[model samples]
Target: MNKIHIIGLGLLGGSFGLAARRKFPELTITGFDISEKNLKDAEVLGIITEAKENPDSDTDIILLATPADSLGDILEKTLNEIGENTLVIDLGSTKSNLCARAGNHSKRKQYLAGHPIAGTEYSGPKAAFAELLDGKVMILCEMDKTDLHLKEKAYQLFEALNMKLRFMDPEEHDRHLAFVSHLSHVSSFMLGKTVLQKMEDDRNIFDMAGSGFASTVRLAKSSPSMWAPILTENKENILQALDGYISNLSSIRDLIAKSDGEKIHQELADINKIRDILDLGRG
Candidate 1:
């Protein structure tokens, strides 16, 4: 019976624990977390066999579910007690920094940096669900640094959870994710902030929020403590994406200001084609 240890039993980690336990009932999962409440919740929910305070527990796989900023320190600390066959993987948003930090370590071969392109606007053990990672893409970055055997183990684990796996270099992953994932978070947060400010003056405005607005603003409810470090970790790529987005907004603003319907129409026509490319069905 192989033992799997999850270092942080939050939504992502807890979901993994649940899926793994369901898929491989013989495997024992030991969860560790700083929060006693979170650990208690995970135990009550049957996400793990037990919750412990020490990271030195015996396990074949260690999943670090801490925030992006705390990954390096946690990885280093856990490496001290990890067995040579024990594979350690982090489910952090940004990868380049964590990859670089773990690359030169003596136990680098045991570490795999991964970002599962799946999550909800929630956190903690209570928010976990078995189907969270189903039909989602799981990106494995900097695989070259991880041992081949351990990489195979990771692939099998994610596959069992019904996730599609993709490989890419850490730098490329960070740059692409800044646009597809990180920027969406920022946009959602700002949209919520703007709408909340407006609602202060017009309380009834919130009642008018449609499905589109709700869909776009859903990520605004994400945990700030989890997101703040991710935004900061991939700051450079995020800033570049923001600059381009702001420039596009300025162009639209100029057209609206002059009432230039022709240019505005053309601009929207070009942008609307994205729906076709993205395969968004007709509303």
Candidate 2:
């Protein structure tokens, strides 16, 4: 049986372990985590056959499931330990940096940079579920850097997990993710912060928080430690997106202040067309 070693057994890693084991019972799975609590939780949930503090154990594949900021360091150490036959893949949000860092390594051809665009506003082992990656998109960045055999291995694994695969350059991945994913996280976090600040005196947040508010602020519940580094890493593109969003908000507010009904109606109508373009349900 092939052995799969998962480092940093948090939500992403833990979920992968569970899903992989459920789908491929022949594979032996082991998990390693820096946090003892996370390791205990993974063991309790049967996400892995065993939990280890060291990642140097023998395994056919190593999944670096650490935060975006910590990926480089973990990859450096993991490369030093794993055999050439072991394929290393990272489940990180920001891929450009990690890809560059691993580019010149001796085992670079064995490493694949992957980002599964599937997660919840939660973290840690207990937050993992077997269905987390089901029907979601998995972005594989800079695949050319990986050997053909390793790439095929990764593709098959993600397919077995029921995820759709998409190829992307690392730089392009970061740029596009900044708008679609990172910006959403920022908007959600700031929205929640703004509401909380207002509620300091109002104390009626729950009253005003209908489904709309809940949906908009959902990502705010994400782990700050996980998001902070991602936002910082993709700061350039995120800043540009934020500027445009703020400018639009200011324009809308000014229109409302001036009571320019015609202009406001026109502006909303123009933007509402997005529902048609994106195939979203009626607003």
Candidate 3:
């Protein structure tokens, strides 16, 4: 793409600009954000070549990296104003809502629904780095609805960033992500809350916390403004995931309470096989 516009200069948007610029130095990247500081920071850090109040009409690509809940409205408005050949891509966490919003738009073919399965538990332009998306999964939903040329263009850009591609239905994407991604964030946030509540009684509780506790609760530090909507948008699947999680926790609790050491060991040992599934072999 000769010219690209990015809306929402947060971690994902900024990182995309950085990687795109590094891969294609000739590309002119312009960024816009509701927060003036974010736009300014992106320009100053060289993540984007310029800061704009809105996307330029003649740009070849437009990327939407706004909060998940706000994506539907923003994507609708973006498609209305984009050039006939310009491709628009959204990097929102949730897809079904955004895809549904674009379903009847005249420029539907120009729009691509995507989610980059990569990030740190950090936000803002300052937290972005070019290597953030390298070797990451870029999931595209409803590709059949997108124009062939536009889809090819998107594939080229994603390929340049060293992303592996996966195609999934929008509904299926949300359902699976609800379990693997959304549910994990909810668990981390609640785990952090549980510890903080206990720390009220034991002031130095964190002092005794180990690396495992720190790692497990890391996602609790993620942006609430970003995650709150994702958890709610995928509420159905998340609720189901929560039900299974709670049931398992209860089962484990009962095992410990009854001192059923054999079953508990078997349960944990079976769960430990996840390492093999994850390819974290012999670590």
Candidate 4:
């Protein structure tokens, strides 16, 4: 890509700029964010070559890393502004709504619905790092709708970043992420809330906390502005996931209350088997 435009200069967008610049030093990277400081910081950090108020049509790639709720309108408007060959990719957490908005657009083929399953529970340009995307998975939805050449361009860029690629239907993508991704954030946030509520009564509570507690609640530190829209956009799927999670929690709660050691042991043992499926270090 000769010219790349990033709409959001936060963590993911800034990281993409850093990584893209690392791989293609000659390319011009321009960024735009609602927060002017983010654009300024991104430029200062050399994450992008410059900052812009609007995307230029001559750009080869436009990465939409905006909040989930704002993606649909931004994407539609971007498609309207870009050249016929410009490729647009969104890194929103939820996909179904934005994919639906692009479904019948004349320039739909130029846009790709994507989610990079990577990030720390941090926000802003300062939190971005080039290696954040290395070895991470980039999930692309509605790939069949993207133009062949644009898809190849996206694939080349992702491969250059050492990312693994996965494709899924937009509906299926939202459903699966609701369970594996979104639900975890909800759980973490609530867990942190519970602990903070207790800490209000006994400020020393954290004195007894350990690394395990810190790790478990780390996602609670994530930006509410970014997550609120994600949760709302995938409301139906997230609600179903919450139901399943609540049922599981209730079962464990009942087991503990009844002093059913055997059942509790069995439940934990069954859950531990998940380690065989996932390697925490890799993720």
Candidate 5:
């Protein structure tokens, strides 16, 4: 059986373990996490064969699930410890910086940069489930840079999870995700913050919040530790996305201030086109 060592056994890594166990029974997933509780829970929950504090040199594959800020250092360290044939993949939110840092390593051929575009506001080992990756899109950035054989290993892992694969330039992936994914989280966080500030009493939010508010504010509950590095790593693209969102908000405020019902209706009608875009994405 092949031994796969998962470094940082949080939501993504734990979910991967569950998915891999269901798909590839022959592979043994050994999990390592900075949080001992997460590591132990992953093992006890049967997401992994065992919980480990570090990877063994004999492990055939290493999945880096640490926050993006620490991923580069962890990747370099793991590469140094593991064998030449071992495959390493990073499932980080932002790719450009992490990829660039690991790209220069002597064992770069053993590493692949990936972003699984699937997750919820919830986090940690408990939040992980086998179905999390099913039918999701996983972006493989700068695929040409990966060794052909190691790419095949990544493809096999992605295939096992039933994830659709898309390849792109690392920078392009970061830029596009900033607009669609990162910006939405920021908007949600701000919305939740503003509502909390206005209400003052937490009970008021729960008593009066509607389905729309709940859905819109859900991302605000996401882990700050995971998001902080992603925001900073993709700072340039996120700044651009933030500017566009702020501009739209300003325009809406102007319409509200003027009580321009007709223009407000037109603006909402234009935004309604997003439903079609969302429909096309459902596949």
Candidate 6:
């Protein structure tokens, strides 16, 4: 009953295996990855006990950690391979599309859609750590559609990682994440591009950069392969988020051009209220 098979041995998959292993040592874990090197690396690193060719017939749970775009195909393939008793969960960032696919599966009650609201700007199995999920929030979408027993097992698995659980609708999850997570990544990538282009003409630009610059541009280091699909999958809500962000930037630029010092002060003061709610620590 403790056998678990994980597909896509990347950062999230590897992290889950490591976390689960440390917390539940008796469980047997196996994994599969499109990159065979990653599958082998995960096994060699003790993240998983072995490499899985397909979803294990006797596995109690299967975790899919592939990119958002490939989630539906992977989910479908795994559903065809696994038995009805096996529980499957996806850790993709986008939820609505994946949840929709799960809802139509013949073994739909055995599937669960989850997004762990935690990760660093890193990818691949080497980026995994046993404490990556500790105390992070795990959002389980469309819980009402999942079977009660599989839901209970998922809750236990997350509990073993010391994660907090939140239940939400899939579309609601996508809309909220587009503004908070997706928009932040898009902003970081753009900021990095702008600074890097400026640095080409001024070598001293980065010499003047501080921790603030590093922190703000950190997400720019994230895997393009991972983010490209996430942005594409959440396009609509992310487009709306971009519109709001761009409007704010245009407003600020206009104020600066007009030398509206008093207006700028008021605008900045209004934005500072966000700090009161967020523990960004001196941002």
**TM of each candidate vs. truth:** 0.95, 0.94, 0.96, 0.96, 0.95, 0.96
Candidates in order have lDDT scores of 0.88, 0.87, 0.91, 0.92, 0.87, 0.90
Best by lDDT: 4
Per-residue lDDT of candidate 2, residues 209-264 (tens digit): 66699899999999987899999888888899899889989999999999999999
Tens digit per residue, CA lDDT, model 6, 13-51? 999999999988899998899998898899899999988
Task: Determine the backbone clash count of candidate 5.
Answer: 0
Ranking by lDDT: 4, 3, 6, 1, 5, 2
Worst 10 residues of 2 by lDDT: 274-283
Question: With candidate 3 superimposed using the best TM-score fit, by how many Å does residue 196's alpha carbon deviate from the native?
Answer: 0.2
Using lDDT as the yardstick, the better of models 2 and 4 is 4
Clashing pairs in 2: none
**Candidate 5 C-alpha lDDT tens digits along 1-283:** 3778898878898898889888989888888898888888988888889877676667767888888889988989887777876789999999988888888888888888899999999889899999999999999987777789767777888897899999899999999999999999999999998987887765554554666888889999999999999899899999999999999999999999999999999999999999999999775
- In the range 174-236, model 1's lDDT, one tens digit per residue, is 999999889999999999999899988888853546658899999999999899999999999
| Whole-model alpha-carbon lDDT for candidate 4 | 0.92
2 versus 4: better TM-score goes to? 4
Query: Which digits, one per residue and each the tens of the lDDT, describe model 3 over residues 1-283?
Result: 7999999999999999999999999999998999989988999999999888677878888999999888888888888877787999999998887888899898999999999999899999999999999989999999999999878889999999999899999989999998888989999999999989998888864354675998899999999989999988888888999999999999999999999999999999999988786874234
Cα TM-score of candidate 3: 0.96
- Residue runs of model 2 more than 4 Å from their true location after superposition: 55-58, 205-211, 276-283
Model 2 Cα RMSD, 1 decimal: 2.3
When 4 and 6 are scored with TM-score, the better candidate is 4
Better of 2 and 6 by lDDT: 6
